[model samples]
Target: MNMNMDWYRIFWHTAKLGNLTRAAQELHITQPSVSYAIKQLEAQLEVKLFDRLSKGVKLTSEGMEVFKYVEKSFTTLQSGEDRLQKLKELSAGELRIGASGPIIKHFVLPLLDTYHAEYPEVRIRLSQGKTSDIRERLKTGQIDVGIVHFPFADHELTVQHLANIQDCFVVGHAYQHLSQKPLTAHELSNLPLLLLSEGSSTRKYVDQWFSSQGIQADADMELSSMDMLIELAGRGYGAAFVTQSFVKQELAEGKLFQLHTKEPISPRAVGFAARRDSTLSIAATRFTELLQ
Candidate 1:
């Protein structure tokens, strides 16, 4: 129990070489030191480790058994060190990310593309869920990083501001009149609206905004995916409240029109999250830098 690692290290080298003089040379120590270390090791382990021979030395039966474990342990230690070095250099590893559906579509996809191009060896795994779900994953070390919508608490996470997002009501060309002129809260209320389900942070934010303006917001249709909202809005199903960034394609192509509101929606942000106390993996840190 009083033995230290140096004795095992010396014994490992001495046993591997099977020559005390050669082991001493590899260890940059003298022959007596090698002899002394092997004696210390055999005494500590309570076994005869080597048999002296005319040429040099050879393992005893017990020595060979212990060498098997010692050899495997050294090999594993070396492999671990090599793996750690590779990770530090960003050469190999997987990056697990947590994101919501809309954020992935609008923001994370392009970032992933660029990250892959730069570090092709890094594997990216993405899990999509709501902001709260993503945060839970980040807290539990299930994911390396998360790009999520914010109005979130700063308790367990380190938040990095990524982009400002504007939410607005949009409709297809069938509702042309709603495009040019800003509508009052009461006027907006009268229109058939498509909204995300209550569990979503977007839904909560929009609901709070409407309540602050003294109007109770209700949706004629509720859907989970933002892409679905955009598509249905394009087909003139109803005015759907969506992040403007996600709909730049539909807006530019004249498929969807952004509605002007008398009470304009204030912009929010998409932020990235990592656990506050833990260090980010090299792959995750590289991806975050790419976003910056």
Candidate 2:
């Protein structure tokens, strides 16, 4: 049966007040409009909803049952509106981010700390993976933002250049003498190399650098973790290619020394990536703004 939902609303108020005139006053309508709406609702339901009295009205048995469901539905709708308002105000909700372990430790942590301080109610989720893994997470809507090495291109993702990072070869006491003189790319390539695994962005960048100088450098050891590479390099296992900013403490304390190269490595960009078509959550948007 065709029914006007407003009739149910009018029926609810009329039943609650037990008077047509009072329901009309509450709904800001005339008494006749309230009476007509209840009549229409009763007609559509094929049941008598109310019985007229000398001074007011009384709900029929069926009218009381319908009121129970209508009241619950309105309450649920009101609760949903309240939740949305909280999210929009940044007082609730979650922010998900993805990045490589080194990037998270050296770069993203500070920004996350600031965001958490300001919005303590918002939950933060972090996922550690390689740049390619981050890209996949972003496309699948698993993460709200991704911190990645620059020069990465994907039509499905939007990237914002955040900072510049310089990659350099470093050594420890065993190879400290190499730091005294600037060596050409070929000279540096002759030494044992400690490289990240093949598919990683840093590995790709380092390989391209050697290729440009007509050197096909080979790694004596390859590892997935930057921390492991740095630790091994500090023991003089080999020259570790790493981001300079990540080892400031080690470099300052003489635990590791930066190797000087005649061919200066150009600085590379680091950036924030997000799905091009997805709108960021309020917490995610605020976090990005904090970094900016």
Candidate 3:
């Protein structure tokens, strides 16, 4: 049967109120229109939807089954509208973020602290992964935004430069003598170099740096964890290539010392990334704006 939505809406209202007059008042229509809609729906469905009563009407057995589906549909639609309203007012929604662990700890956490203080009602979700993995998540609509350390030039993502961070070779008090003099590429290569493993973007950046200087500082040890790298470097296991900002406490406490390089490693950027063509949700957009 060719059924109309208007007729079903009216039938839903009439069934809920159990009175044509009350349905008309709620739907902002006349009583005759409400009655006509009910008649049309009943005729189209080829079943009696309501039984006439002295004061009002009540649903028939068949009508009760129809009403069940209609009630669920309208309730879900109304819930969607309510959620949209809350989102528009910034009182409800979720913000999904993807980031590397170091970026989260050193950079994203402070911004999140302020964001939470301002929009405490908004739910925050965080996922940890490498830059490549986060980029894949964004492209697939798994996360809303990401903060990563990498080369900003890319076709796969819409990225914004967030902060300039300097990567350096750091050592501990056991190797403090290296800090006294600025070492050249050859000089730095001679020292035991602790490098992050091959898969990471940070390690790739460091690898390219070495390549640019016409050398490969052979890794005395290759590590995957920045924490362990820092810890071992602090104990003078070797000079670890890491971000300068991440070791401020160690530097100030004299546990680790920053190695000066003659061939300076240029500053790299921390980037905020999202899908190239995807539209971010209201909460995600607002949180991303803070980084701008």
Per-model TM-score on C-alpha atoms: 0.92, 0.89, 0.87
Q: Which regions in candidate 1 have their CA more than 4 angstroms from the true location?
A: none
Better of 2 and 3 by TM-score: 2
Model 1 Cα lDDT, one tens digit per residue, 1-292: 7856778888899888889999999999999998998898888889999999988899999999988998898899999999998887778899999898998977899989888887788888999998988988998889989888877776888888888999999999889778899888788888888999888889998898889889997899999899999899999888999999789888998889999988878999888889999988788888889878
Best by lDDT: 2
TM-score, candidate 3, is 0.87
Quote the lDDT for 149 in model 1: 81
lDDT of 2 by residue, 55-114 (tens): 999988887888898888777878999999998887899999999988998899998888
Order of the predicted models by lDDT, top scorer first: 2, 3, 1
Clashes per candidate (backbone, < 3 Å): 0, 0, 0
Per-residue lDDT of 50-82 in model 3, one digit per residue for the tens? 999999999999999999999998899999999
Point out the worst 10-residue segment of candidate 1 by lDDT.
1-10
Off by over 4 Å in 2: 1-7, 19-40, 43-46, 54-56
Order by TM-score, highest first: 1, 2, 3
